[model samples]
Target: MLKRRTRDFHQLSPVANALFHVIAASLAIIAVFPFLFVLIISFTDENTLARNGYRLIPEKWSVDAYHYIFQTGDSLLRSYGVTLFVTIVGTLISLCIITLYAYAISRKSFKYRGFFSFIAFFTMLFNGGLVPTYIVVTQLLDMKDSIWALIMPMAVNAFYIMIMRTFFSTMVPDAIIESGRIDGAGEFQTFIRLVLPLSLPGIATIALFSTLGYWNDWFNALLYIDNPDLVPLQSMLMRIENSMQFILQNSNNASLSSGILQNMPQDTSRMAMVVLATGPIILAYPFFQRYFVQGLTIGAVKE
Candidate 1:
C-alpha cells in the first residue's frame, strides 16, 4: 500500500497541472516582452516617442527607422554578407575543433586525455593579456583588416569544449564504442559514422552557441578591420550609432546641435538597428531548440 501510494504521489492533481501551465505561459510572455517592445518601438514615430515615451501601443507609427537604416543599402548588404560568412565559417570550425577534442578526451583508452583536459580547463582560469594577443594578431600574424582575424579569435572557447566533453563522457555508451572497434572501424570512421548521429543534441547546442557568438561579434572587427568592405553588420551598426553619439556628445555649438537634432532619425532608428541585428539569429533558435534542451539537460545530472 505504501509503494502504491508513493507511485500515486508522482501524478499531479488537475488543479496542480493547470497551475503549472499557467506559470509556464506567464514566464513565456515575460520572456517575449522585451523583444516585442523593441520591435514596437522601432515602428513608432520619432516625434511620438519623444512626446509619449515607451509604450506597447504607440500613438503614431512610421517606417522612418527602416528608412534611415536603408539609406545606404549597399553598405548594409555588404555588412550582412560579411557577418553571414563569418558566422557560418566560424561556427563550423569551432564545432569541429570542440567535438574532436571532446571526443578524444572522453575516451578512456586515449593516452593523453589528462594532459589535454588540463589544458582545456586551464584556459577557463587564465589568458594571455589583450595587448600581447593584439600584437600577435596584428604584428606577428599581420591579420589586421582580414576576415580571418575575426574568424580565428573566437573560434574555440574552452568552457564550451568542457561541456561537450562532459556530454560525450556521460551520454555515449561504452558498449557502442567497443562494438565499433569490433567491426574494424577506426577512430575517425566511428566518430563520423556512428558517434555524430547519436550526438546531435550536444553538437547542436555548441553550434547554436558558436553561431550566436560569431553573428553578434563586433569587437574583433573593430580591432582588426580597416577595410570598409569587410565590416560585419554589428560593427557597421556600431559605427553609425557611435558617430551619432560622438556628434551629440561634442555638440558644444548650439547652431550645430539644433541642425543635427532637427534632422536626426531619433531613438526609433536605434531600436530598428537592434531589431535588424537580432532578428535573423533569434529565428534560428526554434530549429535548434529541441536538441539544445536535450543536450543541456542530459549532461546536467551525472550518474
Candidate 2:
C-alpha cells in the first residue's frame, strides 16, 4: 500500500512537475535574498552606501564594518563566549524543564494535570509588568548582573510547554506507557528511556526554538546585567551601535573631527552586526529542518 501510494504520488505531468520545481526554487530564493543582500551591504563602503542609498552592487566595497566590530578583540571574543555558554546551557535547561512539565501534563492518568496546565497557560495571556519582574529578579531572586539573569528568565516558555504537551498527547500512545510499566520501569526510567527516544522530532523542534530565543535575547541583559564579562553577543552588538550613535551625536562637541566621523562605518557596521549574529544560527536550521517540519505537522494532527 505504501509503495503504491508513493508511485501514485509521482504521477504528475512533465509541465506540472516543472512548474512545482520552479515555484520551490523561487520561494527558496525569496527566503535567501534578504540575507545575501545584508551580507553584501555589510561589505559596502559607508560613503558609497550613503551616496548611492543601498545598491545590489555598490561602487566601492570595504571591510571597515568588520574591522570596527572586531576592533575590541578581547571584548568581542568574551561576548561570543558568553553568548555561546548561555545559548547552550539555556537551551538544554529549557528542554529538560519543558519536556518534563509537558509530559506530566500530557498524561491522562495525572490528576493534577489540569491545574498545572492552567498555570502554564495563564502565563501566556498575561505576565508580571517589567518593573515588578525586575524587582523580583534583582531584589527577590538576587540575580542582578549575573549570567543567571539571562538564562533563568527565558528558561521556561509557556508556549513551548504547550507545543511539547500537544506533541506528547497526540503522538505518544498510552499503551506504550502501560507496556513500560508492565516491564517494571519507574516513571523516570520510562520517561528517559522510552518516551524521550520516541519524541525526538518534537524535542528537536523545541530545542531549535529555545536556541534561537537564547541566542537573540538582549533585553534581559539590558534590564538586569551591567557586568561586561557577562554581556552576551546581541547585547554587545547593541552597545556598539549605541556607542556609534553617541559619538555621531556628540561629534561636534567632542574633539573628534568630522572627517573621522564621516569615515566611520556606521550603516555598514549595523548590517555587519546583523550578518555576524545571524550567520551561526542560520547554520543550525538545516540540522533541525526535517524534524521541525515533522514535529509541527504530526503534532498538530488530532487522532
Candidate 3:
C-alpha cells in the first residue's frame, strides 16, 4: 500500500511538473533574447541606428549594410571560404585523432593507456606557456602565414579527449567488442565498423564544438597570418571594424564621394557583419542539437 501511494504521488506531481516547465520556459527566453536582438539590429537602418542604440524592433529597416558587404563580395566571400575550409578539415582531422586516442585509452588491455592518459591530462593542468608554444609553431614549424597554422595547432583538446574516453567507456558494451574479436575482427577494424557507428552522438558533439572553434577563431590568424588573403571571417570582421572607424574619422575627406562613403552605414554594417558571421552556426544548431544534447548527457553520467 505504501509503495502504491508513493508511485501515485510520483506520477501525479503537478506542482513539481509546473515548476519544471516554468524553469524551462524562463531559460529558453534567456537563451533566445540576445539572438532576437541581433537579428533585428542586423536589418535596422544606419541613420536610425546612429540616432538610437539597439532595439527589439527596428524603427526603420534597410539592407544597405548587407548590400555594401556583398557589393564587391570578394573579401567577405574569400574569408568565408577560408573559414569553411578550416572548420570542415580541422573538425574531421581532430575527430579522427581524438576518437582513436580515446578508444585506445578506454581499452583496459592497452598496455600504455595510463601513461598516454597522464600525458593528455598533464596538458590540461600545465603547459609550456604561450611564448614557447608560439616559438615552436611559428619558428620551428614555419606555419606562419599558412592555413595549416590555424588547423594543426588546435587539432586535439585534452578535455575533449577525456569526454570521448568517458563516453566510449560507459556507452559501448564489452560484449559487443568481445563478439567482434571472436569474429576475427582486428582492433582497428572493430573500431571502424562497430565502435564508430555507436559513437556518432559523441563524435557529432565534438565535431560541432571543434567546427565552432575553428569558425570563430581570430587568435590564430592574429598570431600567424599577416597576409590579407589568408585572413578568416572573424579576422576580416575585425578588419572591417577598424575600417569603419577609419572612414568615420575621415568622413570629411574629398575622396568620400556622394554615393560610396556618404551612403555607407557604419553602425548597421557592424551589426550586419555580426549576423553574417554567426548566421551559419545559428542555422546549423537545429541539425546537431539532438546529438549534442544526447552526447553531453551521456558524457556527464558515469557508469
- Name model 1 segments beyond 4 Å from true: 1-13, 250-260, 293-303
Error of 2 at 225 (Å): 1.1
Error of 2 at 10 (Å): 4.8
lDDT of model 3 at position 249: 84
Q: Candidate 2 vs candidate 3: which has greater TM-score?
A: 2
Cα-lDDT of candidate 1: 0.89
Rank by TM-score (best first): 2, 1, 3
Q: Total clashing residue pairs per candidate?
A: 0, 0, 0
Who wins the TM-score comparison? 2
TM-scores, all candidates, are 0.89, 0.91, 0.83
What is the per-residue lDDT of model 1 for residues 11-60, given as tens digits with 9 covering 90 to 100? 89999999999999999999999999999999999988999999999999
- Work out candidate 3's RMSD over C-alphas: 3.8
> lDDT tens digits, residues 1-303, model 3?
999989987784789889999999999999988877877877899888877877777789999888877774698899989998998899989998999999999999999999999999999999998899899999999998999999998899999999999999988888778879999999999998878777878888888889889989999999999988889999988888887788878878888765767688877787788888888877657878877666445432135
RMSD of each: 3.4, 3.2, 3.8
**Candidates arranged by lDDT, highest first:** 2, 1, 3
Candidate 3, which ten residues in sequence have the lowest lDDT sum? 294-303
**What is model 1's C-alpha RMSD?**
3.4
